[model samples]
Target: MEEAAAWLAALDAGSATREEFEAWRAVDSRRAVAFAQVADAFEQIERLRTVHDPLPEPRRLGPVRLNRRNLLRGGVVAGGIAIAGGFAMQAAAREHAETGVGERRTVVLEDGTRVSLNTDTRISWRIKGETRSLWLDQGEIALNVRALAGPPLRLSANGMRFDLEPGAFNARREPETVALLVLKGTASAENRAVRVGALAQAIGRDISVHPAEAVAIDRARSWQNGQLVFEGESLDFVVAEFNRYLDDKLVVADPRLSRIRLGGRFTNTDPTELLKALDASFGIRAKRGESGAIMLSAS
Candidate 1:
């Protein structure tokens, strides 16, 4: 590990040639993992530092000057075997993705309608002249769909389909349910599509979803631009979303607190503030672990 970190510092120092680095990689698979691990380690170090800084806005932190001595020491301190490889890189390419902790992007449809990608969201759309299809693999998104001039517009997730006429609002998919929350437009499950909300599984033989004013499957929305919008959601559900944007995830010390109700518009950058806000609103307590990671427990 010490040797690998020294090699990384040499790479960063611009002293090693690409051919040299490639030659080192050719030596063995473990060497490649060790090399990549240095970058991951640096990222993790930076990410963990934010927990202590607790600043709301971004600032300039000077570059790291890793030397042989510090490289050996830090490598020993931050020891981890990197599992990410060529296959992991290829697996990521299977899906179209964009990520932000609490940010959203408006995706315009063919007929000039817009869809918003929720915080930490990823969406894939396949455009076809005859029929348009979109899919949400994970996270939540809002589809302000426009009327299709020629063919019907279709949205699918986990083998479920939704047909939209004109106006629509939020659409989401989870492991269990698919929801279409039409704020302004009309939406219905396609014929032969037996899809509904998560809890409707037992009664889903007909594939019918009852008309709802607004619906959600996994996570909630935010009132502010990048805030989280949770509605009577469990603590664990909210924490999962918060962790989605974080390199360092929140650990619950007690399982009982995870089921507590959590609702708010939380800033994605401010996990500490989010936790404090939740603690103030609900009967929750928090503690910092020895490593400075935040842990929450129900009081």
Candidate 2:
């Protein structure tokens, strides 16, 4: 799965030459299957990147719950997969919103619920008789839900459902994890009943509620204001966060340096300046790779 995912990433970045891809594809029959799965996932993601009409909700439940296990096997999404089951509710209207690399958008629902989407985020929402519903397929969002004299609003991410209250909060969904941080009001997970001031992390088959003491509210919410403030965060995690904002991704060549801690605030919209800051502060070397990926090494 790692090999497949690496191949997909390389292809997506235009780094994999035709000969190299053909050589890898011929190595094993299973490689073809893996590649097909990764390719299919990429196709799905690409479709989301472009503008599209909202998918008519099937007579069944709301948007299908994306099964995390099926999607994050070996940290790579599998092929020929299907979305998991969803609820049996109906909404009168459906709307889709998405942002590309280095893009952020603020959307106001009909009920005055404000949602500020972070970079590379995708979400869909709708309103039924007395219910407000939202499905976050990918990326992060800061939600400021409005008080309503109606049913509780529902926010679904990767098969886990969150009942939202009239308040402010943030939610981020990744390949292997879904995190929720409440800035105000309260939210309850489908079954876990996670606490406040914590980021609920959902992994395969389990949801762990961890205190978000390490996260500064101002820093965490700074992304909405086009900034990134990290306090003593690992290099690997920091790179991942920055990758969401740029077409060229950062790859740490040295696994040993992946966990090296660093702290600072950087503009979320600028990757070049961030790289310069990284090199100056940590003596890290940043260079462009053949695949157009930025390679980071300990200098």
Candidate 3:
């Protein structure tokens, strides 16, 4: 050990440099392994210094519970694969069970209620007698709360609570701001009950609840039945919803293009067909995004 310490001192003092270390490393792979160990130690220490103690774990509830929590639509979203800390996530190492990029997941809950998780989604839920409760922390998810004689089912997400009445439907989340879209069923957005044909949107410090003449249900299950239901919608609204199920998001560069009315039934996974229909029927050109998302601007 004394001789090893002396050697290190000599190296630090310019008697030896990285050239000497590389020569040593090359002679026996052990030297290279030793250097890597040192580097790893340094990196771990730096990471520990950067992160505070309290970091929440990624949450997941899988296909385990039959009537309690279920991953719908023949989609098996494996449990949340979390990294301990201090490194970027490797693409291959990450495991996610999700609907397609813009697709939907229609899962049948244990109590006969149905849930449709929107694109880029994850959820944790547990069923308790008399009162059904779940957490929708991130992503877009819809719920069709079965008509239960028991207490109302509660959904909490984005700092808001959704009291799903019997035969009520709702989709809401808070990432940047709180947004709730209610159609067919009733959902409590913010504090008010939003019924069929209503859309309520909320952001931090601001909430808006109004009775609208129209509603939009961006459901993944509807496509299985060969329907893309759009209710009193604009061109951009339909395009964006289409992007969620299709691999590409539509890019609407023109501001005015957003206002045109859009109502149609189109097949899922066929954005090109939808665009062609739009062009043929509406005379709008659809440009292609880098990843093939159709972008519609004024032609």
> Measured by TM-score, how close is model 3 to the native structure?
0.53
Model 2 lDDT tens row, 126-201: 7756867887878999999999997667887765667788888899988877878878888877455655576777
Q: Local distance difference test, per candidate?
A: 0.56, 0.71, 0.55
Model 2 weakest lDDT span, ten residues long: 83-92
Query: Which window of ten consecutive residues has the lowest lDDT sum in model 3?
Result: 79-88
Candidate 3 residue spans exceeding 4 A from truth: 1-97, 129-131, 147-150, 178-191, 195-200, 215-226, 229-234, 252-263, 282-299
What total of clashing residue pairs does each candidate reach?
3, 3, 7
Which lDDT tens digits does candidate 3 get at residues 175-291?
766555556667765457787766667665466777654334544336445456776688877876676555556788788888988676776567767778678877889877777
Better by lDDT, candidate 2 or 1: 2
lDDT tens per residue, model 1, 1-299: 55666665554333454457678888998887776656555434433333333323232223344344543433434343232232223223222434455455665655575667765655655464655666676667776667657655666665455666666456666667665655554555534332233221212223544544232422334422555567777878888877766756788888877777866666775687777776788767788788866788776
Give the top-scoring candidate (lDDT).
2
Candidate achieving higher TM-score, 1 or 3? 1
121: Cα error in model 2, Å: 1.1
TM-score of each: 0.54, 0.67, 0.53
